[model samples]
Target chain A: MPTYLTQHQNRFLEELLDWLRIPSVSADPKFHGDVLRAADFIKDRLLEAGATLVELCPTAGNPIVYGEYMAGPDRPTVLVYGHYDVQPADPYELWTSPPFEPVIKNEKIYARGACDDKGQVYMHVKALEMMLRDGGLGAPCNIKFMFEGEEEIGSDNLGIFVKANKEKLQADVILISDTGILANDVPSIEVGLRGLSYHEVEVTGPNRDLHSGLYGGAVMNPINALCDMISSLHDENRHITIPGFYDNVADLGPAERAELAQAPFSAEAFTQSIGLPAAVGEAGYTTPERTSIRPTLDVNGIWGGYTGEGAKTVIASKAYAKISMR
Target chain B: MPTYLTQHQNRFLEELLDWLRIPSVSADPKFHGDVLRAADFIKDRLLEAGATLVELCPTAGNPIVYGEYMAGPDRPTVLVYGHYDVQPADPYELWTSPPFEPVIKNEKIYARGACDDKGQVYMHVKALEMMLRDGGLGAPCNIKFMFEGEEEIGSDNLGIFVKANKEKLQADVILISDTGILANDVPSIEVGLRGLSYHEVEVTGPNRDLHSGLYGGAVMNPINALCDMISSLHDENRHITIPGFYDNVADLGPAERAELAQAPFSAEAFTQSIGLPAAVGEAGYTTPERTSIRPTLDVNGIWGGYTGEGAKTVIASKAYAKISMR
Candidate 1:
């Protein structure tokens, strides 16, 4: 490796580790200050990396970190899309370490935003730095970086920002490294990404938690009702049964399916990697197609009643589920 | 009301409130001292209430508070079954006041275990006091009060205690007042009680929590799996689908069904009281029959990942449910 390249790599990781320590969880109001600090950090880094026209674009939600670099008018323009915010670090007991405290274990960096946009987005800024630092391998292209801070929470402010600033984002093609790859060796590129529609349902029964022994079978239990409703979302064949849920689902012909099926996947190795006896999805599609071509519904979280030490035989008034569809 | 009877009611409520102040949550180990104090309270109260024999019966679990007022073996011996320990007051936010600090609001004495056996059992202790104080109200029967501390849990130690002390517990009949009445003007009685079989199931998928965006559709999510499994527990008609679940279930004769139907109940009032649109159970059974005679299953509690302020998008490793069969 070149001496400057090695030094740049070390500095790049160090800077990212510093950024990762901010805990910029956008969804929670408790981390409001931290989210703002993350935007400031990105803006300062972009300025230090010799980017011109760096600014914090405030929206209805968290501010967007914007920067630009111009090679020449004839150069191809590349617009990069990424986020400075991250998902909330919840179920904190499940995490091995404090989520904001980055740790490297088993040749992998373990943190809430590691390998996410924080890690991916920071690399591009570092690359821009390299082009400015090393004069020989200089950039021959104009680049624009738009890092939003509300992507984790449905990108609530991004649509307005994009519409209001259309001319500033003009480019030949947009670049994004937010999606995950299959493996280090398999150089797979995602041609399309699934859109997300998230929802939460609250099932209620009694006005207050009642003794189950006194009220069982007399009224609906919110937990049982929630479970029944969730179960009905999918049929016996593992197909979603939301009544016209699949009305507009694209139907690929057999020829197209066969072409997609050419991708290699072993069921045993796949399930083994996740410690599952088997994997089940739509009856007729491959695993890759089930995830990519087909939309899927999953329950991200569920809770109700006395989920504590032993048991309380309570018919809780409310049960909740956080559902995500992709 | 009689003069002395009306006067004693005030002090009686005060003493019960004092006893309720001890946080005797039996399910949690942290409340071990409180449980013991509850047992001691009962023993001291029994002695003060003029019981001839009072003792703390030690067992594998929390101790049993025993007291007797024998009017000789010739008279009818009535044994009372009750419990001193209370269920863990969880979801404490639902409470209008701290659970251990008994409160009276809107003509209702509200507290954990205020109605479920604790209040009922304490009334009996007061009844014994009344008999001793009045001397003319009850001298015809021999009474034995047996209060165990693990009834909120499985009553694990009661079986051993009962079996070992069979000779000492010899009585003509068992009288239990662990249930409630309809109203001050109405008289009601429960002929039989539903049996309970509580179970806890833990579903494990991956060895650790993973970012849902990375491994969502690839690996099994325990929350999704749990919802799937719980949803499958019932069928189209809301019948429990466990194999041979209804086997050996006694079929109630038409005459018996008619007799049961004679119990006055308005379906509208039942559902409205609990804030449910409708009541649901087996197709043929009535609400009373489903709750008391026929068996039913319900999830007392359920918990999994990321049930917090914002989204974690975690495919949790473990999911849990506390189910009870009645």
Candidate 2:
């Protein structure tokens, strides 16, 4: 496109890889120093990009790298938000290559936070540098960068920081590059994302565990009771049976539904990819609509009584399940 | 009621308590010597009772203490059966006194296996002693005693022993003293006992666990599917839904049902005993009927996914339940 970007493409990637090697995993306390160092990496890059004000704002958890460049008083402000931290690379053996060691293969970067937010955040930093240093058309509007180090962990401190620095973050528009495109060719933009609510449910049958042979028919089994309760949450048609569960859920019109259905999808391929026999959901929705438009209640975990080795005939006193709605 | 029994009652109790202190737990291999010692106790007591033939019948597991007294050929031969081995005493802190150290409290002996079989088998030994040593009425018929040492376990060796010693175990009639009387005042006999069939059921959804946000409603969750399948096993009336489940179940007549209803029972007491809101079972059946006559299907245990301390939003690859029908 431009001579500056074409000449510095390899340098931009090398810089991104250097930042990725920091292993800023906020979930683990062992990466505390690395998380702070990653924040510093963002601070230096922002300063090098000719930002006038760059500060590593300290929060209860991790630091938030805030940087700003004012093109003019009349120009509209654009706030670019992203994160520097990545989720914990657990079950480490599952990866083909080391997670923190970023490597490129087949024109794709393989790393834990390569495409999540670190790579996207680096793109904005490099774009600002290209426009400022290329001796060409510079930034047309005021630019603000707010990169936090706790997005992978729940962003608990980010909420407090945003509230405390509301004036500093004021902008005409906000652009978050945290999500993904539908496909390379499609270049889709997600209009909305679902919110999450998690709950832990428990069922109590008897005060104490009892021998199944002595008390099977006479007393209630907690596991059975829990299963019954979970089953009743969904009706025969797979629609949730909770009263008023769908009362506030908005229904998409025919045109909107038809437009969503046009997104690239293959039912057979989807099922084959996940190693499932078929895709199943609510009665009246397509696969795409079921995942995007409709709310779903699912049991994330369930347990009671003897689940170890060999058989043990017991009617457990209590049963529990972790439920989540999206 | 006899003079001999009245005079030797205290001694008989003391002898039984001594045998109970052996801690013959067959389920645990750590008690191997104790189990063998308990078998020797039965053998010595049988010999002291003036048995004409006594032998320790060795099997793959613990030995069987066999003893016999031939009163007369014309008289009917009777074989008495019992066991010396007891179930493991675990969570031992729950016991009022040490399980191995027998104690007499409030006129009742407290010890593992004090009443299970060792107590009852000792009664037969003392009865034979009374009839032969007291010189009153003497032996009315030829008697044989078969006391085993692996009843607490699966009795795997007992099966092989019985098959090999068919001629030695032959008798006109057999009296097993292993069961219990309903109540001290209202003594009752059990004509039949229910059989058990156990099954472990599993439901597989995808090949691997999935993220709830990425694939919530689009794919079937194994835990939800398992819950649905388990819930469907019982209908609204609490009757089993398996085909031909009750095809051969014999229905008792009104007279038999009325006779069974005459047993002393209190619904409030039964519910209070187990700390349940109420006794629940198949409709149209009494509490006793549900426990005794009517067959039942119950989930002994159920488990899947993260059953740990906190919440994990996972659609597990597999869900499992241990089900049993009686």
Candidate 3:
């Protein structure tokens, strides 16, 4: 809606395409140099946007890019949080074009990190530049930018950096554009975020894989044992059976529940989108509440024994599963 | 031991070793030539042992080596059943020596089919030779030999061959050395054998893998669904829960059960041999009875989702399991 944004849109798009081509995937160590180069890109862009203090703060993992535009000592401050790195573009064959080679069709850029955080973070830098250079209007408030390079990898180092520099990061409010709104025209915001814990479990039975026909009746198969253990984690009512699992989970009052239910959702559309016959979840809660307000235990992966093209009558020695709780 | 057997024992072992080198693995199609060569070896050995009639009977799969030595019509007939094919030697690294290259180690021959029907079938050919050529001890009964080359692959073609040539295979008694003895000095015989049925199951949830953090509590994970299904196949007491599964199963009487219990058995040794904490089976049956008489259901294999290194928070679109019943 601003004249500055419309006039310099082509240049802004060019800058984003250049950054997207760096392949700054922090999860893989082979991309370490590219990750650092991506940080430098951010540092240069921040400096060009008239930020006074812009530096790359080192950590045990990838470094954090920090920049600041101080209006004055008396003005309220806003801390903007974002990341420069992206999740690995694996199963690359699924993409229509190469991942790092950004392509724009129908006015939408196609790339790994184009949408995630790079696009959003770029908007902040350009907005700051527009206010400082486009018009005579200067900064109305103090703004601190923290663009992390390890956000895609659970942000392992961001916590340490935040703790060590708490005074430097002080602000009246924090703004994060990591999550998406309902629509571009009808804006929406999430009030809360879920915490996650992941774990891997292994069940061992016999010492070696045994012939199913020779020992099936007498020995307990590790796969079957693992299945039995996993099945018991949830009760008949779809509630987690782990002791004290729900003891600390906070319960929202009826008013809050009503407010959450007001979010636009269609059970038919949700089921059809996922190609499920119907939606299923906790017996008492609706689908929206189940995804947002409730904790969940899901087996992300399970494997054991022969899984080839044909049948192999073998009782595997061990079975494993990866579980995640949200 | 007879003088003839003792005198030519070296030659007999040499002939058996040569046959074992053919690599007649019926399970793999890559060894099709080796399988046919194995059948030819059996046919030549039977003829060398003074058999009047020997032929390779053609079938849908591998051929069956049929030979006969008629000891006059007045004597009772004996049908000797065996196989020249061996099970595939896989995970080949586990073998001390090459599977197809026979080796003598510590007075025992090492090969895939050494103790199976190949060795046992060789003994029958050598015995017929010894009786006809040594000390003029001519055959005492009409002996018929039927060595199939598809026993390792469920004997698929053998059943069809038997049904088609029932009259040609007729005999007063059938002798099969396919099973093992209790010891070299102690002989043992099995009165019956167990029947087997195998199956593969698939559980499908969503059309595509979903992010656990976004849809975990709402969507049903296929791995968890498959585990739940597998766990319900047996009851708390380990008895199969399928209806009509045991309708045709026969129960052994108290007298037979007592006789079976009298056989030499050590629960401690059985448990220790397999490196299990303890032997577990159906609630009311002993380990021996469970393996031999009682029916069983086991999940031989289970697989789904990410089974690679580290963790992947994904709810898989599909999960699979292989089950076998005995």
Candidate 4:
């Protein structure tokens, strides 16, 4: 007694559940077979959905899923990009249900790649099937699918494949549905992403852990040395201390900043959410501006030796920091 | 036919090994039984060594093992101090064998209390046995043995026990086997030890870990904040910046300092030993002077958030430092 649209929606959900079951984790070689299975499954589905020239394009790394549907001369061509791989399901004991075993609980499909591309990509495949089956939908654009298996592992092979066959892969524009949305209802469309500049710094003092009591004053502890270096990264006004770091940094005009400030945000709510007495940043800017518009130097992580038990009088040999500049 | 010492040495080692088998770890409550057993074991051994009035002097915490031996008039009274307890062998995984399971590997009696008083203290008990057994050995001093079960823990009850029994505990001077000896053949007696003052400092900025990309430039990270504050503890010239920190510090005369510097030392070997390019300290002082004579500030341990894996873009809520001034 269900309508055709309702049945199609049910079919889409069922198919996605099948795709999510494969633990196609490209980061780990243990999931190599699963990753291959996931890629083949996508290739078969695209062919069944009326895509011609469907093929699993092999590379040195994981294979790429390629398929295209040609329309009449005047239709604009659109290339759709997605990935069939997922991040590693690590600290595996933390998961309530197994990462490979897909289950719908609280109306949310709990799986490794449930939302990250596998779920999002499946929607496009089913939408194309719906239009093909209904026969009432006019062709708005020519479609090309280029799903890779290595996006979760930095997409090493895809760039090589693209550069080698640029003409074959050419399209009007590429559309991607991968960026995270805020929530089901209160979501904002992401136009672009912030580029990240990552650096790892290691400071060495003594070659090995030394007794702090025996060599406390004479030795320079790497933790303390590292802290000193990190402290100097930001000056008195919290300005970055790196030489010429802001040379290429984009600065917005006052009018633009004022317009951006009009966006809804509450500093009080922000403080309460993260549990702070108040917010602090670059002297002249608001919290939002400092985050989005301004460049930042952050210590993503820091570590040394002997961070355990009652006390160990150790001056660590080395200290490491992972800093991100955005 | 071996000497009496050879026979006694074998017996002393067997007895000490039996004592070391008990896990007298005072830091944790689970080892309460072992701690008590250790105290009783010490009392029994002291009595067997011919000490009179051996008693397990109870306190709020673990008991104090007390014993005495007397001689006729004009013998100088001597109080011998030691502890039967050992530090918690945590990071127990780092040990080659179970902490309580004593083993002699590579000519070393490798165990939790091997070098600490269990080994050192056993030497005194056997010497007492040897003197008492010899019968020909003259008594130059009247001895009182005070071995406690709470040295690994801060000797909290021993103070109360000592204060309450001041008259009974009285002696000319205390003979302690606690301090370190330099080497096997080149031994020098340690006359005194450095006084330590430790403090824990906590720096809080935000209430929780925030996404570094969203709140980085605007939010003050506690790790960075802590670093800034710690860096200010010493000026550019390496002089401590704490007001009146060096006010009551004793200054050695030029002649005394020159005499102290005359001790045999190799600057190159010292640097190579600790794997430092060069030693560092206050403006004008040798490494030995900086370590022993002058007071020092050191970060024994420091920690915050996201110290694991490749990268975690988190602005941690709190940063902590365990600082020591000696």
Between prediction 2 and prediction 4, the one with superior TM-score is 4
User: Which parts of model 4 are misplaced by more than 4 Å?
Assistant: A1-74, A80-139, A144-162, A177-187, A253-259, B10-44, B57-64, B72-74, B84-113, B134-139, B147-158, B181-186, B197-208, B240-259, B317-321
Best by lDDT: 3
Kindly list the per-residue Cα lDDT of model 4 for residues B1-326, writing each as its tens digit.
22657766667777888989988877667888998998888888888878867888999989998888887557878999999887666546556788888888776787878777788888887777767766527446788889998775557788899999898788998989876543355455555556566667888777656667678887888888888888888887677889999888888899988976776666787898777789998879888788777888888678776555444556777778877777
When summed lDDT is taken over every stretch of 10 residues in candidate 3 chain A, the lowest stretch is A179-188
Consecutive 10-residue window with the lowest summed lDDT within model 2 chain B: B305-314
Model 2 TM: 0.73
Model 3 lDDT per residue over A94-209, tens place: 57889899999998999988987888999899888888875638899999999999876577789999999999999998988877554456477777877777788999888877
| Model 3 chain B lDDT-worst window of ten | B179-188
How well is each residue in A16-130 modelled by candidate 1, as lDDT tens digits?
A: 8999999999878999999999999999989988788798998988999989999999999999889989888876776789999999888788888887789889888878887
Candidates, ranked, lDDT: 3, 2, 1, 4
Badly placed stretches (over 4 Å) of model 2 are A1-165, A172-187, B1-165, B171-188
Off by over 4 Å in 3: A1-77, A82-157, A180-186, B1-157, B176-186
Q: Report the C-alpha displacement of residue B285, candidate 3, in angstroms.
A: 0.1
Between candidates 3 and 4, the one scoring higher on DockQ is 3
Clashing pairs in 4: A275-B207
> What's the best-to-worst order under DockQ?
1, 3, 4, 2
Best by DockQ: 1
Window of ten residues with lowest summed lDDT in model 4 chain A? A180-189
Which regions of candidate 1 fall more than 4 Å away from where they truly are?
A134-136, A264-269, B134-138
Q: What DockQ does each prediction reach against the true complex?
A: 0.66, 0.39, 0.51, 0.43
Comparing to the true complex, what docking class would candidate 4 get? acceptable
